[model samples]
Target: MEILPGEGVALVKVGEHRDVVESRIGPPVHPGRSSRAVYETSPMLVLTYTGDETVELVELADGDGDGGEEVFFDGVQLTSRFMDDVVADLEAKGYEYEETDIGYRFEPGFAVFSMGSRWARDLDPDAAEDDPRRVVEGVSVAPYEYFAEPAEEEIEAYISSRQSGGNR
Candidate 1:
């Protein structure tokens, strides 16, 4: 599968209706209540819908180590690669990102999370930087608003505070 960032996967795009998605990929493996659907594709596909039933978020997650499928973003393979390597490649491509609690959130609506160890809720701190535990586990794409900055009032407040050294 290929991620289109602020758009959607190659098979579906954000803002597409649920029926359109179902027609292209068939029915979801498990229909979620109201606003979500899960499909049993190569790398499992999950779609979140808006109140009007249009796709709002698209997620592709790595399946078992059996290598069920592969996923890519802008031609760069995402699944199974080390987290740092992926970040480096993205940076090289001029994609700016912010480190999230789980992984990295890139501009224009792309985010990836680490898998971590099965026994731990978070990544194992003692694991080597190159450890497999740090490979990307899942990737998500959404509309620009999903990664947009706060409201203008909030931004102005923050700017004013910073200028006054209130936050320092």
Candidate 2:
């Protein structure tokens, strides 16, 4: 997809939606409500798919802030590198993909982005769940709360600590 360099998405408000929000990029996509379209401006092309509601993504091509191309992921090449340094502190992780061409749905996770900045990893739950980019037919739905539920081991650990008369 070759979204125009200056293409961007309008974060819609909840409870206000167009019955037929259309998009035409490389070809005829999203001719009706039966499918949702995710329009990308930078990298170009809108992805059309069959699903519930409109959860599309504007795929931005890697570019500099000046629209000169960007490098999406820079460092950390191999699994070994992450496993040795980063993965050690992690537990209970899996992937759940939203079946849409627009954007992706990350259940039980968080994102952080400033007013004029891009999103980043590990967002504040209260804040991330309130991202303006997240909406369906003008209705803002609740974002999946990451780390809301404790794993079994974490629960057991908590119990053990309390029972052991240790500081909580």
Candidate 3:
């Protein structure tokens, strides 16, 4: 699968209906709630739909290493590359990003989450250099605005809803 950052992943562009996705990729192995589906692709594919039943987000996550499908961005293989190396490449390419607790959120609607490498105290010090936990655990693509800070009104609405038990 090819991740096109803010656009989409491979042939599954955002804004496509669920029916179109099912027709293109066949049925999902795990049909989730009304808004989500999971395909058992090499690295597992997850599609999230909006209330209108249109694709809103595309995510690829690590699966059992049976090694069938490979996810790529630019020319780099995302599922197998180490997070440090990936970040270095991103820097070289001049992409602006914010470092999160788990991984990185690039400004171009791309976010990567890393495995629990930092908490793996039992790992060998030498092997830590190539630790599997350093690889990306999952990656998601959405609209550029998805990464933007929420508007004050949106935040206030959320707080008010929570206070009133409307979000509970």
Best by the TM-score measure: 3
23-134 in candidate 1: lDDT tens per residue?
8889988655567789778888888999999999998986535666867887677766667778888888888898878888888688877757432223355765554446
Clashing pairs in 3: none
Could you give candidate 2's per-residue lDDT for residues 1-168 as a string of tens digits? 111212223432112233333322332334554443434444332332324444332233222234433211113111111121212222223434232332333342311111223332112234554444321111012234421356899899989989888654
Candidate lDDT values, in order: 0.78, 0.30, 0.75
lDDT of 2: 0.30
Measured with C-alpha atoms, the lDDT of residue 163 in candidate 1 is 89
User: Lowest-scoring 10 consecutive residues by lDDT in candidate 2?
Assistant: 76-85
**Per-residue lDDT of 91-139 in model 3, one digit per residue for the tens?**
7888788887778888878887776644222323456454555666678
Root-mean-square deviation (CA) per prediction = 7.7, 18.2, 3.7
Candidate 2 global TM-score: 0.23
**Which of the predicted structures, 1 or 3, would earn the higher TM-score when compared with the native?**
3
Which of 1 and 3 is ahead in lDDT? 1
Clash total of candidate 1: 0
